[model samples]
Target: MPREVMIHPLAPAGEPIPLVLVAHGSRDPRAQASTRALARGVAAARPGLDVRSAFLELAEPTPAQVLSALRAGGAPAPIVVPVLLTRAYHGRVDLPAQVAGFDCAIADTLGTVSEPLLAGLVRRLREACPEYDAVVLAAAGTSVASGRATVAGVAAELGRRLGVPCEVAYASAGGPGGADAVAALRAAGARRVAAAAYFLAPGRLYDTVMSDALQAGAVGAAAPLGAARELVRLVLAAADAAAPQLALTAA
Candidate 1:
């Protein structure tokens, strides 16, 4: 995709600062489609907000490029909300670097997991399978200690929510892949194990874990959390959290 600003069609005169949703770009075409769908959902949920989407890498309209365009267009400073589920590489490293010299309000990443997010996961899991001995929350997996910790935290929360033993597994770049985790659950006497994809969209990692988990004895694996209304609300909240910062920037 070309580097361009996606302004909302209903943007009013002297609109508040724009909301830029920064997603970890993917090479897969479906990834872009998912991201755009998510942006559209956000825009629909809050028609008065000027919501736009950008990529951190492997896609166009990067954070830096978006900032440049916003500045050139005489737009007010934007509130950048990372569409990441964790505060790992993209959130901690790439985002800061991209907006380092720019004037924008940067919100924290969505987090390892949250209630709204878990709702989406649970919805997917229920749709995939009705019965399961154990649940595995499978993330993309990051080598960063903080990222791993976030995943673990989310797993713990998910365990509480489901009232089941939830294990944290990685799809890549980490240890204990989904297949292995599910297998361990089975070895521990679980007859049915289901894997819940922690990914935001369908991509290589999502596909890998979905295949591995199912092949490794998992009865079923939930689909990725793509453009779900729960996620749309979460993204809007992230952008809203940066409102104070946006006000400061405009001042």
Candidate 2:
């Protein structure tokens, strides 16, 4: 028997269960690369699993478009794994609205702040700079209490686990933005401040925020959390959570 490779959404055959990796796309090359790398990592973790990637906005393969493409290709069911860290516009409103009538499973956002994720974050922090006069656990920021709580909890836990003084800062929410991370640390009497980027990808927002902030005397900007091995597991867990235990076919 001969097997064929299905790349396009038009390709048909078997009820392939598509694990759609959904990310908030950015113009930054790093962000784009991170999304692709994460998708690859997920597929690697689940060898036989049919995994794919899409963007929430500012990129290609929107939810509806990807779902339509997959459905057209005759996939049995597709699960949407939001690569978002917070339940902001994309996770809370945009994603739901986009996939309202779609024939697929919508998994929770990838911001579960799992133990492995926290561990990985801590490890990255350690690697970024040895001395954290004051560690500012930063995030994209959100108005939703639940969303803020999730990231904040992670930061608090990380601080406790790592045994350091950690505080939450936002880069996009306009409150205590990343641009102020260094300033806050300096004000707090930090000798060498480190901005622990609580982000998944790098982009204009991240670059500008960190660049201007670092110039203000912060030691260094820790890399964004993306495509790490633990990240793959987190996304898969989300997919499994969204999937029905009974495995229903697309109607």
Candidate 3:
């Protein structure tokens, strides 16, 4: 049989679906737990989707393991939903490699300018600390060319939404660090800037980002989109995209 051949379900269209929610796992248990929460939230919103969480690395249930589970369960088709915020190595290379010879399409990552996503952050910021004058989105830098593009894309969207300049910075890897973002805000004439750490959970990176941004004169760091309802919508959108062609499936 040729590769990329997805099996059809004998069950009706209204039947539930099997899905894999992939994440760029971390050594931090909170990170793993957060992904688990995302999968669970997706499942809650759409009971029709059988969501499963898997890590790209440094966590259990790798993509290969997820594929095995799907195949063993005899799922007609399984959609791979990446929990990543950007299309870096895990999204471009590691993810595709898992399904290269296998059957299934991958959904897009949690790219920056998510309308509901950004709104969610705004709301969270307003509730937590309304004094902030600007929002700074910070992520771990990646050497990949596409990674920078992803951040730029998100920053542009955010910039448009807030009616103020939104900036991007990195906590590590190659990047314009968070401090750089603060400087840019200052240069752009922003008086008070808030840091929105894009990290999923608490760990060394998360601590470093928060500490540095706050010390660098940021108002405060907003919460990560951990189990946010808007994020669930984005995840579902990705799932629908990767699911086999069916006009009724999205309904």
Q: Among these predicted structures, which one has the highest lDDT?
A: 1
Candidate 3 or 1, higher TM-score: 1
lDDT of 3 by residue, 26-126 (tens): 88898898889988887777645578988888889888887887878777556788888778888888999876765666778877566766776666556
Candidate 1, residue 99: CA error in Å?
1.6
Runs of candidate 3 exceeding 4 Å displacement: 1-15, 245-251
Cα displacement (Å) at residue 36, model 3: 0.6
Number of clashing residue pairs in every model? Answer: 0, 0, 0
Give the clashing residue pairs of candidate 1, or none.
Answer: none
**How far out, in Å, is residue 169 in model 2?**
2.0
- Deviation from native of the Cα of residue 12 in model 3, angstroms: 6.8
* Candidate 2 wrong stretches, greater than 4 Å: 1-16, 245-251
lDDT of each: 0.81, 0.74, 0.73
For residues 60-145, could you state the per-residue lDDT of candidate 2 as single tens digits? 87878888887787676678888888777788888888888877777788776678688668767777887775777777777788
Give one digit per residue, the lDDT tens place, for model 1 in 30-135: 9878988988888777666667889988998898888888889987778888989888878988899988999888888886467787788888889898898799
Pairs in clash, predicted candidate 2:
none
Kindly indicate the candidate among 2 and 3 with the higher TM-score.
2
